[model samples]
Target: MNVLIIGGGGFIGSRLATEWLRQHPESKGKITLVDQAFLDIIKNNPGFECIAGDFSDPSLIDPLLEKKPELIFHLAAVVSGEAEKNFDLGMRVNLYGSQHLLEKCRQLAYCPKVVFASSCGIFGGDVNQVLTEETAPKPKSSYGTQKAMVDLLMNDFSRRGFVDARCLRLPTITVRPGKPNAATSSFLSSIIREPLNGKATSYPVAPSSPFWILSPKQVVRNFIHAAKLSAKDIGDDRTINLPGITVSVQEMIDSLEKVTHKGITDHISYEPDAFLQSIVLTWPPNFDTKKADALGFTADKNTTEIITNYIQEEHIQVPEK
Candidate 1:
């Protein structure tokens, strides 16, 4: 399949490129990756063609659609914190940009498979309720609102025979391997990554605040799996709440302590900030992923396995507990 990854320069997108190529070594297909920038590794890698451009721009994205990539992975977005702070940017990229891409695909008339990276942020301010497939989205943040809107659009487009879309509502991806970005949930990775590297990090929420998390490993696997499913197998809705494990900030700290030496979690601290709390706390914590379960999707075994996988995957030699 001729594949296109919209946010391919980001860590998740880059990793997805590698994993996809690894799985289909015998296939003869072109993979194109577009982003604002690229790491030397990605740009230099012979596995895929890297394009530096903004997907939100019709000038840049239009010509890309001309290539008619058979499999489109729409992973680019403005993320939560930045999206909340800058409504215009979020609306432009997260909402309008996506609509432009969908319209372009509709013009092609060759219904391509689109695997979208939606978020649990779409379900907000209902912490007491366990989010299920039937749960309605009442987003409290602009980021969530944008994603929820796109989910609706993707569903409609798929139902109308414009695109074969699969919208996977992703959990907060954790244990990322670099400096934290503008995401409000960036603390989730910082609390684990920084401490393990012998640096200090702090969170802007309460220790008991719960987050729905999935490891990067599982996210890639599930993304690939989503692309492989037939429309009937995926059902009519075209959206699946990808399974994830829920853990509080305290539990995440505890998981790190379990997998590493004592002082590892000691490097983590809580310095509450109302702004981040307002956005993150509004997100619903728990989910019922029975539909995803039936579709053969999977999540990390546990938070401990999540941290362990990150360590091993990064080749970080840590003193075990």
Candidate 2:
């Protein structure tokens, strides 16, 4: 099937494009990747068409959909910390842009299966217990609020037969290959990424502070699984929290030590930023992923596996001291 990936230039988006192509090797249709920019790898692929533009612009989105992409993966967003710091930019891109895309999908002659990349950040503000499919979202950040809104739209749009959609509420994906972005949970990746690159990184929260985390690999798998799933499998609810393992900040560091050397632990330091900590502290550390698990979604085995997988996948070079 012809596929369209919004924000296909970003970390998760780019990886999903690659993995999707790998999984569908004998496919006949071109995979269209729409982003503000594109990676050379995707642009060079013969079976892929890379479109660089703003999805918020109806002009841009309309023409892209007219190309008739039957499967769409929506992974574009302003992210948590950036959205909180700049409300207008966040609303325009995260909220308004999402609505515009949905409207375009409604206008399409054929319904497309949309796999939206939502966030567990949607659940925050005194989330002290394990969050489940039934947990109500009490979003504290503008980013979280926007994601929760999109989750609603995904459900309603699917219910209305506008688009066959599945909103996967992804956790903080760790060991991202590139430099950190504005997302507050970025530090979670930074702690492992930088130390491996021989640079020091700081943890913005307490050592005991836990996070529901998936690896980049698992997140991509979830995206594909969501897209390939039948409407009957998802039922009426188009949104579900994807499976992830919860690990503390200290536990992540410990994993780094296990994967690399004990000396790698020295590369990490704690210097809590209250703003970051407040946003993080509000998110539930654990989740009951039984629903997602039963639905065929999966999580990482553990933190050590998370680290080792990153190293192998990224081909990271462990610096010699």
- Backbone Cα, N, C clashes tallied per candidate: 1, 0
Cα TM-score per model = 0.97, 0.97
For model 1, the stretches where C-alpha displacement exceeds 4 angstroms are 27-29, 319-321
lDDT of 1 by residue, 1-321 (tens): 789999999989999988998898743248899999999988887778899989999999888888989899999999999999999999999999999999999999599999999998898876999999789999889999999999999999999999999999999999899899999899999999988888889999989888999999999999999999999998889889999998999998988888887777766778989999888998888999999999999999999999999999999877444
In model 2, where is the ten-residue run with the lowest total lDDT?
25-34
Please tell me which predicted candidate would have the highest lDDT against the true structure. Answer: 1
- Candidate 2: tens digits of C-alpha lDDT, residues 8-52: 888999899888888897552478888898778878887677888
Off by over 4 Å in 2: none
Residue 185 displacement in candidate 2 (angstroms) = 0.5
Q: What is the C-alpha lDDT of each candidate?
A: 0.91, 0.89
Q: Name the lDDT value of residue 110 in candidate 1.
A: 94
